[model samples]
Target: MCAHITDSVLYRHLWGTDETHALLDDGPRVQRWLDILAALAAAQAEVGLMPDDAARAIADHADVALLDLDDVAAETRACGHSTLGLIRCLRRVLPEPAREWVYYGATVQDLTDTWTALVLRDVGALVARELADIEQAARTLAQQHRDTVMPGRTHGQPGLPITFGFKAAVWAAELGRHRARLTEGRRRWEVAQLGGALGTMEFWGDAALPLLDAFARRVGLAAPDVPWLTARDGVAEFVNLLALITATLGKIGQEVYALQRPEIGELAEPVTTGQVGSITMPHKRNPELSEHLVTLARLVRSDASVAVEAMVVEHERDGRAWKTEWAIVPEVCLYSHTALRLAHTLLDGLRADPDRMRANVDAHGGYLVSEPVMRALAARIGKHAAHEVIYEASLAGRERGVDLRTALLADSRVTAHLKADDIDRCLDPEAALGAARSFVDRVAGEA
Candidate 1:
């Protein structure tokens, strides 16, 4: 039986993927633990801490498939030791001389932490690739809709004019920053953990540091300058970064979900012909992909909090903290990967209703152009006075069911210098989208 929610059969689709399944599966995990033992033996031999022939023999045949996993599990339960089962299983497979040398001087943390590093390294590659794909999709959308004007909302209310390109550019920029964060986190997270009992490497004597470096290189990871048995910051930092990435994707997803509303109709996620939205309501086309991204992000954020909590570990090795990570880190990575994958798809097939955007913008009868009008009026009067004048006119217009132009034209304080034509020109949605295109260009250039 699996211990984590990611491995649960019922909820698996929400929090897991094949890639993560492969990375965190029992078979792969045991194989990696065996690989760690093999590398440890080789490193010990390379530094003259163990017999070369013994190390070679252990490395030659440390196959996880050859072992009796049932016996290993029984021994694990009996001994209450994390890797005693692994050691016994490997010993059974190794020659007499090499049997005793397997997992020579390493502790549970050394094995588990090294495996954690391996998982992080692999998951990091997956995340980077997916984020890159997402960024590319967002870039494509931004470029394609460089001037597609829409009403930009604030607090769920239509407030001002903005281009679809500007919205996409924001997503691209956020994704680009996440890519950078992932890149930076890789170095800090991909380092090895070879600290022995008490993290002193005392068991290996003089061969410790070199063996660590050699072992890490053999496993294609960086050797830490010091033992990180209790320094859980790297793991915390890595998961936190993943959380940030998911949060940004979730933000984009939330926007899509909101804009796909029938009342707004500014954006729509791709709807395949045969896809079912609701059995009761056959005509509905829900933003399922976008909404799922948000769900994945929420789960990732929760896992990230768990990861951060693991950072407050006690002493050199805390099973409580490290064990929590065994569940949380992989969960966060899986959730993040899901979010990124769906986010890319959401962006790639995203459909914008330019006509609907214009219609929505026109529905308010020039209220979205309030900023432009206010700015133009500020040139006549001070900004504060102009804001007050516009606010009263806007209120009266809302009460009387007329455009701001009609109300402003009726007010002598507003009509003293401005004519109806000037007000009409200021209320143009296209004209009101100040610097949106420039911002889109800037994002493209920066990205």
Candidate 2:
């Protein structure tokens, strides 16, 4: 009966993690809302805006276990208001004196937005931890394959040699940037929201600012400079960062997908025993984890767009804009977490065929080292002229079905300055890996 794939018993594992689901699900969500209300009451009491005993009573009875969710839903549907149903249901459990003091001077935005900030704070920490783990895994790969040579392709054609370590280092560096971003942006997005009715907090009078700070302290978040009733840039920024992180994961997935091809065979995703790639094809090891990373990234990207769209709102409070976040934020969080999890698994168990990569390069008849040859010839003739010579030689060699060394040896233009030894040096894959190994070391050190 689950309407969305995120909630579906069968498909939920692919779309979200249990940790995120716990944070966003109705049971925990409602409980957090109650906790927030309790914190508000306690803050009001601290500011002398409400009675002390009422705050105590409210805090003591803030448990969500006491409320019937079906009744809450029924009342919500009947009243056509967002938080009133929960407020009324909460009052039923409170004593007479504390009932009125429960949600004093607060609005739906105050409750929901503060809850969102708390969610961001927790989710941000989770993401940072996951990213750190992923970066370490990538750094390990970079160190392990510091000299493992592979064909560095451009536009789907082999261009020159590059170490697999260099590729993994690139991933590690990008992930490190995301970790930095999360650290820098946490304060901006994890501040409390406490705007009442039209964001003025006029109902709370002179005590409003103090109460805001107290409420934030109770909830373990920072007090915002002002209530973000209309400014949704923080939410948008958080989701967009998630988009960027997932996109990087998707890029890694795409690389695995392309390199795992039978013709290429330079890399492969981990396959467990008895895992079936296809129902009909008996000989297939599909890239399910890698492909799913792409899928999760695309969905998270879509959710990020919705978060961005929710930034454009009307006046002090727009239900159209902020309400969209009620759905978009949680979805983005779930999808992003799932991507990070899968990416960690993929990187941890990844298989790299150094021999296959070298063979593929050799199969191209040393053409993958064309860049080094072009550069050596460029020293003799100007760069453009060397490009012309190499271009012509490459074409003729392909037509004649001979190695680049044979084709270049037959051409007077190449043999005039460069002998067989020079060509052999240029064709050396290690020699062609200019700065690749060093870059891996640099990135690994940074990581």
Per-model lDDT: 0.86, 0.93
What are the per-model numbers of colliding residue pairs? 0, 0
Q: Give residue 302's lDDT in candidate 2 (0 to 100).
A: 92
Candidate 2 lDDT over 1-447, as tens digits, reads 989899999999999999999999999999999999999999999999999999999999999899999999999999999989998999999999998898898999999999999999999988999999999999999999999999888898888889999999999999999999999999899989998998888999999899989999999999999889999999999999999999999999999999999989989888888999899998978899999999999998998999999999998889999999999899999999999999999999999999998898788998888888989999999889999999999999999999999999988999998989999999898898999999998999883
Models 1 onward score TM values of 0.97, 0.99
Instruction: Please estimate how well model 1 matches the true structure, expressed as its whole-model Cα lDDT.
Output: 0.86
Return the TM-score for candidate 2, rounded to 2 decimals.
Answer: 0.99
Model 1, 209-279: lDDT tens per residue? 88889999988899898989999999999888888888998899999999999978889998877999999
After aligning candidate 2 to the native by TM-score, how far in Å is the CA of 365 from where it should be?
A: 0.3
Best by TM-score: 2
Q: List the residue pairs that clash in candidate 1.
A: none
